[model samples]
Target: MSTEKIPQIAFNPKKNKVLGVEIISIENLMSRNQKTDHSPEKAHVLKFNMIVLFTGGESEQLVDFVWHKVSKNTVIYLTRGQVNAFKFNKNLKGYLILFTNKYLEKQLNALPQTTTIRLLTSHLFSPKIEIPKDLFIKKYFHLFYKEFYKANETHIDTSTIHHLFVILFNKLERLKTNQLPQIKNTERFSIFLKFKELLESEYAKNRNADYYAKELHITYKHLNIICKEVVHATAKQFIDDFIILQAKRALINSTDRSSNIAYAMGFEEPTNFIKYFKKRTGYTPNAFKKIHS
Candidate 1:
């Protein structure tokens, strides 16, 4: 058997639908797999944002190559560029809300500035939010489903859907904050967020902490202090972890060979890349690919 390269799934609105948002039941989505040709069981990199709320069933979902146990009230937030694959079981019942980054950004920009909104925009934190029988979440999802797919509507009222989406994110943000209290330091977190934005775009070209510090307009020591305060890792360690994660994602998600991946990731010599990977992960690139493949 051979593995397929993880696809880059883009957000394409359906016919006559102007809104970038779509909500569908898991059962309906799985049933259309054959016609749609995009099975949930396979891994793919997303080009948009997604929120999957599992209202029933027990299964594991793969996010960024790691499997997470999910059950009732488990909400998974998958942002753009993350690798995602769903384990669809017959008994699983849920709702998937898919939207474009542009749609989400526009709604976010219209909202007031707050820590919760900031956290929702920043992708530096965990993506899972487990709500234990929360009534508000249940009601919100129910209401959203009714409005999103209501019959007799000539066109979808995107404004209403956007408001529901904001409410959902705010609730998820509260839960995430409780799970990660260190993000409460608004000042440090703001700087750290900027650092992360820079790292995401420039990690392939530059892995040096000094470069990021210069881009953030802060001294190296100051950047390190902020990194430690927010994520409990030094600036350099954070950069290494991020790049290694990107490497791991590429290794498993793509069919590219180690040497090819090394060159794409800015390594001049594949041998040096192999050595660096081994030092950080205790496994050669080929070995890691074998284990994860």
Candidate 2:
């Protein structure tokens, strides 16, 4: 595969429209894709969060290279920095809601703490959430669709739209609770979130769990405990897994040479990075890239 960088779609809303939120029909998206240079079916990374609600037909979506089965009532969430590609079926019908992190931050600040926490933690797990069949709850999707389309009007009540999103998210949280392990220790979870934030910004420079622990102002043991409680992985294991994930994304998304990718990921030597990747993923960096590519 050539080393061309994957296409990255930034949040581009219409002029005078709210800077963060956009909702479009799947039909419109497909039409737009035909006119664009980038194909939705090809693997590319996103620069914003997206929620796609499939209201008809069935299909598969590639998120971070994992193909997930999706169908009616399946809502797929894609966060920023994740590699994804859409399999657009003629029968597929839904609405795609795109929101910027800045807009999400605004909503979170006004939302209930539980809503904020659930939304934040949702990114850590599976992106697909199967909404149960219920007419009343399903109406929330229509409400959001209706509310968002008003953006073209002279004045749109964004506050009302934001609240509708909060309600929609809370409903999804209820559905998710049925699928996930019970969350324990909010305080520990909070610390884990902080650790994640730091890791995202520093993983290219620091992979040591000890460094993260120190940055978070916690001992290594305490950090490990937090990691275990929240993600069922040791601190070191979590750090390594994150590094491997980033490596895989880079491998598939960039045209850079393996050595350059390794160096950019903070490895002192490309050989050590190759060995480390092989040990964790059972495939050398170039081999994995070839397979994924």
Candidate 3:
């Protein structure tokens, strides 16, 4: 069933919110889509999680500038504020699950911090997972999808949705843990996750490790300890890596001037930004763009 056609999609943003979750397909959402650029017009940073489960056909999703394959049994996961775009086949068949942070955070809080919860929250982990398409897999989505629409016909039973959500999460955990073992449940892991959440929201303005440590009510030394224990890196290195990644994403995806990109990224001078980028990446912003563009 493999084809040689390259993935393509043109996108204009649309508000795709439902009561809590929006399950859709590219075929159904074609109005906001098009085919031309292998890339999106610009990078997309969503405020919610977008999960695409490919059941048929072939395509690619440009997630944070990495083109991930979308074929049978492939799943793409995009976390909030992570860049993504559709470079995809028109013939592809898949279910796209979009749900808000509020919805996901609320649900996870009600459950224990199991492997499933870790997979759902860890943003640095791989964003795509491929699993076999079988009844066990189909059952999870079917129950959730059926209950979602049935509630629309009758009445919304939040519990029904949550029950199905738990089952589906476990299935996904199995796939993720196979690739990356579940992180231990410890104070360090908890601290690292909290720091990560804060960084995702605050990385743009507050790049200092001390700022994050203060916000998390932990010492900077303690934060470094937690980060090294979990990710094998220092807290400051993690923050800088995130900043550089966002900068690179802006440089490669947008046509804005380098100075503009630097200013938007909170640098007072373009020279400093350039130096910082080159120091971390060994290439000037323009040079990096030359390779990507």
Candidate 4:
């Protein structure tokens, strides 16, 4: 896939609109433009949020360089700026809902520090959740699909769409809490979510717990407390993991040399970089390269 040519489709009212939303079955999404489009299986970055809800069948999706295997009743959420590539089964049965962040962001514009959207944008971080399909829940996707395809309104009442998303996100959050391994941790780890959000944006420039703590306007101790509460790890360890993961991504996906990568990751001493990477990953830069190669 050409990274530069990642397809990003906006809500085209002329095509289909539930006011910034569109829903298509996985079968149709795969074949909709096969005659005219090239590389339909290639990965692309999204400019809007896309939610794929599967009723049955199995498939895998690459999200931000991580591959997630999903099956029946699995829900995969992809937000703007995330790279997504699909590898679907022939009998892929699912609902693909695409919606613009523009309208949703405004309604959820309050800062993470200010209001509790209660992680309304939480899916941006935790993207996959699985729950068995029920007639009650399957109805939303059908209703959304119906509304989106039938939307002929010139000026759609966005409130209806916004309410739909609120219900959907809230329901997913509840399921995520219940279905995830550590049920109790989700309740008190709101700060952990903010930490991840900030780290994704700031990790390259700042990998220190102190910097993240300051950005979140919380004491370093408080940040560590939240990290332990949520991930059973220290804030420093999380920061290190974040930086190391970014370095690994660069090593795997980029053509840059180890020395250049070390310097780029703010390693003033190259040996420190090697030691740090080896400490966590058990592989020196060159060794990791050879293995991946």
Candidate 5:
């Protein structure tokens, strides 16, 4: 595969308007020749709700922060908003399931099991849960992969794909629960999740703790208390971190100049953004891009 051409697709619910889900076969993404360099690069960003499965090949597996030797029948899940990179060889095979968060939302409104999986959002962390090489889960994954191919070939209805996705997700949840004792949602963690949602929607216009506190229907002091307890940072600190993350993502992905990235990230002046970035990341936007690029 031309590692340079990372295949990507966006599932816009409005356009597709399907009742069920979609699945992309990862095997279809691999080049016919199969041997390719494994170095990390900006892989494609997939925007949709989905589960991703991977079977290791000859190349060392390198995905974001996680590294492991290629093994048979290995499976990995990539939910929405998670970015990934990988290297592979001839035997690599897997599937990428794309669905809507609405499917999960209809079942459970709050982000179920997100706290356990939140480390995935960072490029520098990996889960401790391991998939046994010869376990029954592998069989289920194979079944799901077969269904995925059938779905792609129009042999199965979208509803059948949706049902498979639900079953797979439930199994994954069970695996997670077994590996890590379910983290009880403390009042603090609950507030943090709400704060995070509000941050994503209003980060551009509002960065104040009091504003978030008012919107969350909690006192500023109480909000700060929750943030400090769960995130080990004050509310303002979390806001700064969120803004810095957005700045980094825009800078890395866009062809725009540093000044343009700053303005796009809601900074009134490029210089102010530069100053803020330097304070948090110890580098200017241009400098950071150079390092990552």
Candidate 6:
């Protein structure tokens, strides 16, 4: 006569509303089950305005162009414009730090390029440091979590939270300095960073390597050499990939007509856009929307 009970599914990040630092929790964000299956479609798309920290569990084999796995006692920073997916096991326990771009921008506004904030922005989406599983890092993480929780509870007084956040940033910066060695700088690396920044700003209007070269004050040949050296891809390939990424984002986030989207993204005509998109993605824009939707 006894009825069998159904098992509960873990909390899904995709189903939840985006919360800022003022109203989020580490425990509340995680699932009770250690092992959970997640599809790429269920991956949480981080809107560019916020930062998030996640720990524990191996991620699902989803397509991630820019994802990083942190070591124990390490904190991974995800700036704007990067997306990733995760699959957590039961022992996955970590704090997810959420903050706004505006929060960091204010401080960075006064700093020069060599400063930590500005340099960090340039290396955004690139994992830079790996904190060891030492007592110092453990204590810092604990303090960060405590201060973050206190900030969430005292949501009305942001001044207190700001101070706490500054402390957190200082600790992270110290760890970054002490734990990680500097990566070698090369001409190709410098060019790649410049190209990435330019691509972010001008991907809609300019897809040609020549145009990027003009902006960077370098010849097209030099640009190509640099890109090939650093990324092992041609400048055209990088542009194509950037365009495809934008197309994918538009397809997922908007319900705009295809023609409008095409024009908005700098295509001369809808048909041309369709052709280019299909060539890169193997699906028409409409088809892409349907598949992702």
For each candidate in the order shown, give its overall lDDT on alpha carbons: 0.80, 0.82, 0.70, 0.68, 0.61, 0.57
Clashes of each: 0, 1, 2, 0, 0, 2
Candidate 5 C-alpha lDDT tens digits along 1-293 = 12133334366432235544655556655652245332323454455555556655544443432355545545565555544555655676766566666665654433356434453333212332356664565556667656655544645555655565556666666656554323355666667777888889999887788999999999999988877666567899989977887776666566678898777777899999999999988898888767555
Best by lDDT: 2
Task: Show model 2 residue runs off by greater than 4 Å.
Answer: 14-16, 118-123, 135-137, 150-154, 177-184, 214-219, 291-293
The sequence of per-residue lDDT tens digits that candidate 2 reaches over residues 235-272 is 99988988898899888878898999999999999999
What is the C-alpha RMSD, rounded to one decimal, of candidate 4? 5.4
Arrange candidates by lDDT, descending. 2, 1, 3, 4, 5, 6
Score every model by TM-score. Answer: 0.85, 0.86, 0.69, 0.68, 0.68, 0.62
lDDT of 4: 0.68
After superposing candidate 1 on the true structure, give the runs of residues whose Cα lies further than 4 Å from its correct spot.
Answer: 1-3, 13-16, 109-123, 180-187, 214-219, 252-255, 290-293
lDDT (C-alpha) at residue 80 in model 5: 56
Backbone clash pairs for candidate 4 read: none
Residue-wise C-alpha lDDT for candidate 4, range 217-258, written one tens digit per residue: 899998988777666679998888778766765665556677
Clash pairs, model 6 backbone: 34-89, 34-90
lDDT of 3 by residue, 209-276 (tens): 99999999989998988787666779999989888888877776577777999988888899999999
Total clashes for model 5: 0
Give me candidate 6's TM-score against the actual structure: 0.62
* Structural RMSD, model 1: 2.9
